[model samples]
Target: MAPGQKLYPRATVRKVVKAHSGCNVSKNVDVMIFLDYMLFMQDLMKEATIEAKQGGERGVTARSINKVTKKTLSKFKG
Candidate 1:
């Protein structure tokens, strides 16, 4: 993402979920899902960034993301 672009917050995601599902989630569930999602993305990005650097990319470009996505997902899989 570009500079200053914000990730979706937990409240925003909860609102979206409620809009789609027509039900409210408990606060604890929402927070747990939000934090897990954030942490997963953060870890995935870190792996992609390292791959990008190894590939001589100036930044984490789409190529780097695509290259690392499958491996990252497998690593993060439960």
Candidate 2:
């Protein structure tokens, strides 16, 4: 799985449940809840990553503008 990929395919759920079969948690209810929780978390993480990326881009633009303004002010003063 590549970094930042949030796709939680059914195959993954099946694998997890199969791996945990010895724990008596292979029931439909338990599996459904687990899958739902996993999907919810994945969505939250995806949103957070996207928001952070957008904020970072805005920060870069703000810094660039600040730098240009400072340079212009310095030139005017000199």
Point to the candidate with the largest lDDT. Answer: 1
**So what's the TM-score on candidate 2?**
0.37
For model 1, name the residue pairs that clash.
none
Each candidate's number of clashing pairs is: 0, 0
1-78 in candidate 1: lDDT tens per residue?
A: 999998767677788778887977775667777687888899889988999999998999999999888987887676
Query: Which pairs clash in model 2?
Result: none
TM-score of 1: 0.61
Candidate 2 C-alpha error for residue 67, in Å: 29
**Candidate 2 per-residue C-alpha lDDT over 1-78 given as tens digits, one digit per residue, 9 for 90 to 100:** 899998767666666776766454443645576776676555544554555566675333444444345444444341
Residue ranges of candidate 1 with Cα displaced over 4 Å: 1-27
Q: lDDT of each prediction vs. the true structure?
A: 0.83, 0.55
lDDT of 2 at 9: 71
How much is 72 displaced in model 1, in angstroms?
1.7
